[model samples]
Target: MSKRLIVVFFLLLLLQPYPFVWSAEQVSALSKQPIKTVVTDRFETGVVLTKKVLLPNGDLYWMKRLEFTSDHREPYTFSIPLSGSNGTFRYVERLPAGNRWATIPVDTKLPQPSGFLQTNQMSMLLNASNFYIKNVQGTFEQQPNPLPINVIRTLDGYKIHVHFPQKKNSIAEIWGLESKESLVDWSSTPDLEAIWLAIDLQEHSKWSWDGYYVRSPQTYTPYSPNMFWRLPANYAAHSFIITGGSRAADDLGWVMLDTILPNQNREGYWETLPRSEWLWKDYGIGAGFFDTRFNTDIATLLLKGYRRYGDRHFYQAAEKYSYYLLAHIDHHHYTNYGESEGWLPADYSWKQPHKKTHVSLNHHLHEMNFLYEMYLETKQEFYKEMADKLLYGVKNTKSMWIKPNHDLHYAYLPNGKMGLQDYPFLTYNDLVESQSLFVKIYGRMDPDLAELMANKKQWMDQTGVKGYRFFPL
Candidate 1:
């Protein structure tokens, strides 16, 4: 062959797509074998098998590596999946060492001995004083009262473990913090029994200091730099916590509701930015525009509040938000694609022409869930019809579902674009989340949908960021 032709041939070979195995049977077989130095078809952007060790107990540890080959980072912002039957998941920088692990529990029902009403496992970390120990350890003998805590790395965040003397009532505060630089000396214990009895309660039991709700240590605050002003979303979330049952839930619940009522706009939508208008204005997004995501979240809280207090007002507020969402549905594509415009601008009345609409499968699913719940409560056909339409659109969209084999199918997106040429390369977690949502909402509706659901679940069980066991591509 000519030298030029040989070069062309080698380039053709290099251009071959990543040869991922796309079947459960094949992946399961490969997983049982010993590790290899180099994994076959190991795409740089995908999971690469580095080593597999077989323990004496017959358990295998597959050390797979994932350095995302592409630049898309949004969906792959890593999170440890909820394992077993527990309804708990956490955001960790890395996976845990053992399969048997438990997330540090958060109890909204119990008040901190002296901190704030809106305190959780995370919020308590704001004040170092909340980190107290009953029985001091020898190693921490030289350490100060707010001792250096031992923070264990988990899939999402730190699992703090303060070593107690192993006695029935002995305890040490601040096992460790992820960032030691932020540690401060905190020394106050209002109710020592309550604080020591429940290790999970991090924030001490003092309602709002001055005016601002005490912020949780785990709360992501980049969006709103100021922790002082309580946004509607935060207020609603804090209110939802107290509805469960606590000695202070009744008083705190009324306080949250009273604070939330006045924020409602003239059209009944709640304004989230009485204090942080410039925070959003920088994005060309208007200040008073109500967010569907926040409203949906708050609506659920209101529904819970209604259930807890048996108040007609809570029910009415939830229904009001639901109606606002229904009215904002993108009428343009309601028939064409069965999609509802997911977001609206602050000055939508005047800025409608300039605002470019947005929608995604996940958003649609979330809205459908809210609408379905409303339909159940009101027995309204309108909400049911809306939910059914979204389900039907997802099921019928040819571009959305990809079935590689009889037992394996998953979903992806060209991000809902038209006339896309390349096969969409997307995140494994996104597929799991969206496809699982599809299965959850529509699995029982039809046999065909149920089969698709089963396939996706099977695929998800085997799929991971380290390496997808079986992928279509």
Candidate 2:
């Protein structure tokens, strides 16, 4: 066949109907003797056996697999052998009160078939004496006491029902017999609610740290010892919400806030103290300063916590950090730093000063946006004014806007012309972080801007880009 025709044929085959297998005599016998009562260890029992009913074209006809199980503590095994070309079934072990069962798949296409066939050649050992006898081809043996059985046929398989006494409350096991040496092992007992409850209890217990919330799996180290300030912020926020804003929750928040505030302030620009020998020797970044991406997240979280809780201590700490960010703002009209403008080269270490003063827009936007929220939540005029100036400054600067590209929506560049020479991917996490700050800021001043951001959010979701990590560098 030509390549295109071959492809089309394969596509058509993919769309073809599934095969079905069943016997008309077996169906008639099942319909006549609807149910069977068997003397077994269990007070109540039910069995369903299913086989595929196929059409001449090798496509499936509607059917369901037979299901069988007992609710008693009797060690029993059952098996059904397929005398025809295609046959499959499943056995189940059910719980006491509910309709939940543990299932096992049984396919009669195993390599060996001698052990599966019965000695009498009339019955399949469902479980010792409890047998489903095919007296002849496609015909079941007539019983003195015919049982009421429910047979349901569906697109995938068939369901045959065999009923037992309903008074017994014990659990049972089920097995599918292929032969003496081969059987489908399936066993189960019901405790559904208790299982879920136990899991939930264990999860909560592991997630809790001395009545204060940690994400999951209890840890020895406190939240503050984790290095990054964002940890404490998230822990505090989540704990408070989980506890429904209780006093104890508020206290934990305060404790974490108190612990993180000092470190944040030390990292801020206002701290004029000399660098510790270790700080300079190890980090190589100037005295006790937090200029990393982590610092920005920490600051944002702190500000958010303060806004939500209305704590004076948190507000004061936020104010100190805000002041630090403000001090570093370049107030120049054209270029923030003249010909020395543009992004700081990736190779350029913060420890050694370069001629250019390229600031990451992500950091700048986040800090300014957070400060703006603080202003709105607290009605601080200075914050509002500072935020406006920062926004205006960013809009006029050519260094801040990135050029469009195939690899990324926009790229942060040291110089506008270079256009993502270093990094090329637009990551979902980065976009969410940036957009979150943008929404928070715009929501306060311009609702229209926030709405536009919301529309962009739809695009992010529809393209399935919100969760993917797409960074090229």
Mark the regions of model 1 whose C-alpha exceeds 4 Å error after superposition. 1-230, 235-258, 274-284, 330-353, 401-443, 446-473
TM-score on alpha carbons, each prediction: 0.41, 0.36
lDDT of 1 by residue, 39-96 (tens): 4344424432333333222322222233333433222212211111212222111235
**Best candidate, lDDT-wise?**
1
As a whole number from 0 to 100, the lDDT of residue 264 in candidate 1 is 55
lDDT of 1: 0.37
**How many residue pairs clash in model 2?**
35
